[model samples]
Target: MAATIGDRENAQDSVRSRKTNVSESTMFTQLKTREPKAQENSSTRSFVLLALIFIGALVTLGIVYLNFPKLEEHEKQYIRLPRDIEDAKKLGNILSLYKEKYFYQVLGGVFITYIFLQSFAIPGSIFLSILSGFLFPFPLALFLVCLCSATGASFCYLLSYLVGRRLVQKYIPDRVADWQSHVNRHKEHLLNYLIFLRITPFLPNWFINIASPVIDVPLLPFFIGTFVGVAPPSFVAIQAGTTLHQLTSSGDAVSSTSIIILAILAVLSLLPVLFKKKLGAKFD
Candidate 1:
């Protein structure tokens, strides 16, 4: 009778152990299911935050536009953001008329507008760069364009750093990974690599601005690289602006020679890395 009681007790213990195991497994499975939902919610929050910030920036730009000195009825039509060469030409002519009379207003307007477009990855900054040449002196135009590009690109970098990671990973995961690998290989000479990137068409400027921070590229290097790296190409655009009246199309700004020169500059940017590697090998 004692042996029968012992067997019944052992069976009860076995049943309790199975129940515990099933309960633990269900808990883990529930957690696993919850994790993805949590991530989705987080992504949704980030996207909403970005949209709100973008709207705020647009509102600020609108305020600037409103504050701009009043214009004649005829001038208003040409004052819209230039989307094409003709639009740029019309805008340039109008801005030039006011440039001498309202120097600060005109300069501040261009500076703010250029930055706004760049900070949001908006198009038409290229036309603005060209217009800079038309409206300002060579040295001033170059400086303004460089400063605007760096500042605006930096803002974009920060935006991406804050809330762009998930979006970038979601939309362009493969591209981000590829660029990250490239960035890792040039981690030691990142400034030069960045300059090379800016000089060439291998990556778009917007992509670099958005991806640099996501890949852990430092802001100082990114800013400096953008400021200096853009000089060569900006030179071409600003130069084109000088003859804005003569051009039939924006494509007229770039020639085969400009492309060749840019290619050479890109190659030169990598020379320092090549030299460093060679010296390291020699010392070893």
Candidate 2:
């Protein structure tokens, strides 16, 4: 009887071991079945994300084009103020009065629109900055202009980071290929290059903002450099707005002195990079 009991116990142990193995094998099979599904889900999510980005860019471009000012032949013909200095003063006065009547509401709209324009690399940002100075007092105008410009620049940076490079390669392949070598060489020092671009008057600010993200400059350094980089020029333009009435001609709005000061500051901004290069050479 004891021998029979031992045999039964051994038989039960063998059965339990077999059950455990079957359970583990079932779990392994389930995981194997799910792996392809998980991969498919991940791929689907990526596609959705890319599609949304494309749609968002299209909407942004549409809005910018819709709101952009119509360019008259006369306005295009003159390099100076689109109109004479006196006419600009009248428009400025009108905008000021409109701002007073609507108070924060109108100002907020203007600020939002300006930010959008800046972010989209719209062509009229220079005019918008001048208009801000014309419509508001120095401190308020400066604050609005700086905030909008920074916000816009940040948007451009994000757009470039996301899709600008691909778009550039697709639409402007020649330009991208030409600049690719130079961009790659200075990729590490992109922030300093961006500052130089911002300070220099030759390239349009809008173009720089749009292009920076494509070249892979990180956002924090870009924002810091842009905020500080744009201030001097913005201040000069805002200060000029103050003397809108004294100007007999469009050229009077920006004097040679203001241009010289801006040029000097722009050159000075490069000093840090130059000094670093000198120190690096000496150490080497």
Candidate 3:
């Protein structure tokens, strides 16, 4: 009777194991079936958000253009958003012609356009910076370019904070994690680090703009660092703008001398952080 009881217990245990395996398999199948649908829904949502933002930006550009001072029929052709150095030269020439007559109009237009390009992480702000030099005085051009960069970058930061968390987590999880680690190491001296980043090309500006908020950098420091950090590079671009007629390409804006200057500035920006560390070590 004891042997029979032991046999029944073993048989019951085996049956329970089988049931558990079947339940797990069913769950696995359900997850596999749902994953693709979940991914599709996420993709659809991302597309809609991007579409709406693009349409809104387009309308804003149209309004700015419509409000711009009138130009001759021939000059109107050159008034469009510049894509290349030559396009910039054409736009610069037309703006230089009218800038004196309608100073605020031209200034406001360039200001808005520069911010627009930066906010969207678009590719044409370098040309615009060069154009700013061509159209305005050195001091004014430098200030305007720096302000536009900071404002646009801040806008990008806000957008990423609002809608980009999921996309960044999904698409570039590893990259974001890596940057987050670096950001963590420099959390105390984030402003200096940001300034250094702005001065050097360790990371692309667009990537920095998008990844900054993801890494939790504060907006005030982001703005101040960008405002100050971009000044060195903007100086080069604006100076080059004075000779806009001489430039054959955007590459002309960055010479070996300018690169050396920027490298020095990047190093200088980090000095405060380095000093703080040394002081902490000594005190400790």
Candidate 4:
């Protein structure tokens, strides 16, 4: 009788094991079927986004042609950076010719260029910043640069949040995890942290712009911090525009004064964290 009961128990265990295996097998099959479709969809969306950005750039150039044909030479020259003092002088001469008519169009061109370079994560925005100084005065240039930087980064934030976030998790899980923990700790002071992020160059701006939303950063802080944080650097670039012609090298623009200012701002951003820690200690 004991042997008979042991055989019955063994049969029940075998049935349960078979059922578990079948369920797991079905789940694996489902995952295999879904993954390719998901990747294809993600790829399609990324391509569409790139297409739209390039289209916008083309439209901007078209607007310049339709409206300001006489400034054709100016348009082509202004399309990229003035390589040196002579180039700057020639472009300046063209711009001065119809400063009244070209004022709005010049701004439009700069605005579109800024958005294009920033949204696509292109590398030429530093040149654009310098160009802003070359064309517009300090205040106007600063405004345009900050506005475009903040807006462009915000778009990138949204883009990453929607599509790139999963890829980041899949590939750089450890690095993302570490950053997430650090970011989470300062969630309450996100704006300050963002300022610190913008002021310091340890992390590339493109990375911050792409990764911010993925890590659950709010948009307001991102925008405000970007607007305020980039001002110092923008100021340096625009100020250097006053002497764009005299500039022999790009490095000559970011003077020591500006670097020191940025450093001070970076240190100031950390003060809040330090203050909070010391206060907690005193209370304890």
Model 4 CA deviation exceeding 4 Å by range: 1-27, 72-78, 81-93, 170-174, 276-284
Candidate 3: where is the Cα deviation over 4 Å? 1-28
lDDT of 4 by residue, 1-284 (tens): 99999999999999999999999999999999999989878877876775776687678767765676364643565535445545555655566556666688778766776776677677767656776887787788899999999998887777777667766666677866777888899887888888888888877888887777778888899999998888887777778777777777667778778899989989998898889889999999
- lDDT score at residue 114, model 3, on the 0-100 scale: 93
Writing each residue's lDDT as its tens digit, candidate 3 over 142-222 gives 999999999999988887777676777778888889889999989899999999999998888888888888877888999
CA lDDT of 163 in candidate 1?
87
Per-residue error for 249 in candidate 2, Å, reads 7.2
Candidate structures ordered by TM-score, highest first: 1, 3, 4, 2
Each candidate's clash count: 0, 0, 0, 0
**Candidate 3, poorest ten consecutive residues by summed lDDT:** 159-168
Query: For this target, which candidate reaches the highest lDDT against the unseen true structure?
Result: 1
Work out candidate 2's RMSD over C-alphas.
11.0
lDDT for model 4: 0.77
Which lDDT values do the candidates have, in the order given?
Answer: 0.93, 0.68, 0.91, 0.77
Query: Residue by residue across 25-48, what tens digits does model 2's lDDT show?
Result: 999999999988886675566456
Clashing residue pairs in candidate 2 are none
> Order of all candidates by lDDT, from best down to worst?
1, 3, 4, 2
